[model samples]
Target: MQLERGVRTVKLKDLPEPKPRPSTEGMTRITGRGTSMLQSKPLINIVNVVASATIDQRLDLKDVQKKFPELEWNPDLFPGAVFRLKSPKTATLLFSTGKMVCTGAKSEKMARNAVKTVVQKLRKGK
Candidate 1:
């Protein structure tokens, strides 16, 4: 009898380390929709997920910008902006609304955690 075998390959790239943004708790508010009394808060919009691994990996802003030119890839403003996660195997998405959608997360907890982290950062203005 004969047996079949399969092989997988992995590649390494020089990606940038995750850079956490500053806290945004006391940051000034940015004008948004609604009446003047209703001010809008600042937030991060993470998008795309090219690849990820068990261990945390770095993300290439330039590459991501090249891919999604529409998005405003501002490292200074929203650093630590990652679309993919290692353990959860998930990707984040942003929309015009003040909400984010996390896709591909292994479990609900991962998705919630991702959103919570982002929200906390936004609240902190980081």
Candidate 2:
């Protein structure tokens, strides 16, 4: 079979017989007289997740900032307003076109929750 690009073709019969590996099921490898090498499980963690969403209707950033005094919006620095939530610990960017980008969430569910929470807070401003 051709395994790689610009390489020679390997025939099935030309290959040496594969040796069977010793089963290590429920057993550890002994390196020293009393020391055994045990396989370790990998550590994995979800640190951050980013999610974006769009509201159909156009938004008035000034009006939103007026209603929610806690929202940070400076036209000179950025066009989007920063809405921060403490529960899911996320910051969502709100634009005049009604587009939102939520960041600093730990997982997909937390990202969705943060977006939904921001939407709900905006709805309450009306």
Candidate 3:
């Protein structure tokens, strides 16, 4: 089929109607366990929320690893210790510089909770 740009053209077969596109007009952030209330299907779903925090003092990665055996730490391979939480299902990277980067959280509240949990566990070891 050839379509003319400037001039008019005619075809024997009628043109089919264009399909309606999925709308994201009423889309908003999800709250609690339920999804956003929209006329059409949800256009967005939050898979991961990354958050960062820092402490005042330096962290002893070696001692932290020893204290929390569940924490995965290999200074030779990676400088940060991976501390995973079960409740929020988040992985927080703990560095010697007292810096923390949390990932795999569904929401900001969940990310904050995950970081708080990790900090509490670290403090308990001291």
Full-model lDDT for every candidate: 0.48, 0.87, 0.86
In candidate 3, how many clashes are counted?
0
TM-score of each: 0.31, 0.64, 0.66
Which candidate ranks first by lDDT, i.e. highest?
A: 2
Model 1, span 1-126: residue lDDT tens: 333334633333333545535663344545557433324355755444322222133444465456555445466766534444454555565432333556665455666766665444444533
Please identify model 3 stretches exceeding 4 Å from their true place. Answer: 1-42
- Model 2 regions more than 4 Å off: 1-43
Clashing pairs in 2: none
lDDT of 2 by residue, 66-92 (tens): 998989999899999999888989999
Q: What does the lDDT read for residue 46 in candidate 2?
A: 79
The C-alpha RMSD of each candidate to the native structure, in angstroms, is: 26.3, 10.8, 10.1
